[model samples]
Target: MSSGPRDDDVLRWYVGVPIGTNPLILMDFATVLVLVWAFAITAVVLLQLFFGHSLTGEHIQAAARLATRLVLLAAAGFAIISFLLLRNRYTALYRLDREGLYCENMRMGWGEGGLGELSKSFHWRPFAVPPLRDPAKSVTKKVPWRLVDKVLPLEGTRTLLFKSGRGTAARVYCPDDGTFERALRFARAHIPEDARSGPEKELQQS
Candidate 1:
């Protein structure tokens, strides 16, 4: 095989998928905390409106202190949310040429060509999506996502990674333009008929 893709290779289609732990899990917990905070603040405000007249100055001061705490708590919730979602970035790369395809599961931390140990590789004829953990059997040259971030949206891209190969291969979902489907078909047709198949079951997202 050639050392690298050529300039006029006519990159028919390419895409990468990024993977990350679900933010929904963190979101659910954050919701609970927010609900508790809202309920507590509401209760305090109600009590103050009804009981402020009879309450001593000290009691009103205590209520004010409680409100302060709620503000701080709200700020903390925002921070937690940013931490959970912002920090999480799932990334993958899938690029195809007339000859073969190049896909990488970057969310596992393959940024740039730094996939050194984390990258997976596949070629056209006798096409294959080899696993990274099983390195001895596979000899793939890492393929970087030269334009994954530029062309595709992140969420859609992230969902793309976990299709079939966990990190190496992916299921071609309802593509709006069939880029993924074409890539999958191209891989199957061009890659070895018996190229190592991916795991039996994989993460499925509609």
Candidate 2:
């Protein structure tokens, strides 16, 4: 791991998952399913409202069937997206600085050089179904330290999860024990004392 640009002494590292087996990938797939189901249900309700149809057991069953179909479609879409990402050996660079944590999926393999630049120039129109963008071109999430309500360390996966009241704000995937230790130490220093949890808090108490 190395510090980022001259502007800030940022701790940064790259995490590459060639197979898309990371738990975060599954979490994203689940999120897609949830959103698809939500949309399907909302559409059904809106259609019923437009026709002045009251809610009934039959309508509920029909909604369930529709949701199942939508979930299947979402799963297919997820598979295609995962394939595209894994085919390129998905790589993400994580940077932790004074302000917050920044995670950017970098363009790898085929999507590099001039082609990647060309893709970056293209913009999606509002309300239009956008094509599957390069994994590197995906939106990045920046989680501020102030919103970190809990720091959860998973020894099995060598991952440190920064969580807020809402949910996981950021996930730092350490490549090794040394990296994990360094990240945990940095988290302990920045995160509030009251938010500390697990064995770290116990050790601190002692």
Candidate 3:
């Protein structure tokens, strides 16, 4: 919400599920546990069938081995996936300023601190594949306000669609009604006059 023109302007809002913050991430971890539990139970059931009522130490040991292996594999898979997801979320930063909207993809550098610093670096790698470095490629965009086409209100957030030929868009969660209204006002003010009139006319008629 800090709108200052300083070197470190605070982002007004964020879009994606934050690292270690969204409950959905916990649900994903729970899924891994459930899968491991199901595999262990199935293994135990199979062992019970083979051993019948005369279940012995060897049968228990076999089931234990199967369950341990399954649990280890599931945990390893979950950890790798969660690491990539959190890394991507932690590095993304989108903001709207007086001049325009901006998005930056960054990499972590020495001497940085906190989550804010983490946003400086891009960390997503599909299956841990490193991205090819391109010196000519830009990691940030500062789109002018007039180039924005529409500001659509969503449940708990808003999406701004760009009029640029590329069809780019940015989504931001509005923590409260006041913030939402302010974002809408800024978006409306920047939209072209002809583009704004059509929506207004339709609303009045309805």
State which candidate has the highest TM-score.
Answer: 2
Among the numbered candidates, top lDDT falls to 2
Candidate 3's C-alpha runs over 4 A off are 1-88, 91-98, 105-138, 157-166, 173-177, 200-206
Checking candidate 2 for backbone clashes, the offending pairs are: none
Q: Mark the regions of model 1 whose C-alpha exceeds 4 Å error after superposition.
A: 1-18, 21-86, 104-177, 194-206
Query: Could you give candidate 3's per-residue lDDT for residues 51-135 as a string of tens digits?
Result: 6856767877777787777777877765565445334333334566667777654443233342234552243210111222321
- TM-score for each of the candidates: 0.26, 0.65, 0.39
Tens digits of lDDT, candidate 2, 47-161: 8767966877777678879998989987777666655533423445677777778877554535443223333222211011112234435547788888898788887667787
Write model 1 residue lDDT over 152-192, tens digit each, in one string.
11233222332222333333221223444444333333333
CA lDDT for candidate 1: 0.37
lDDT of each: 0.37, 0.62, 0.50
Pairwise TM-score winner, candidates 1 and 2 = 2
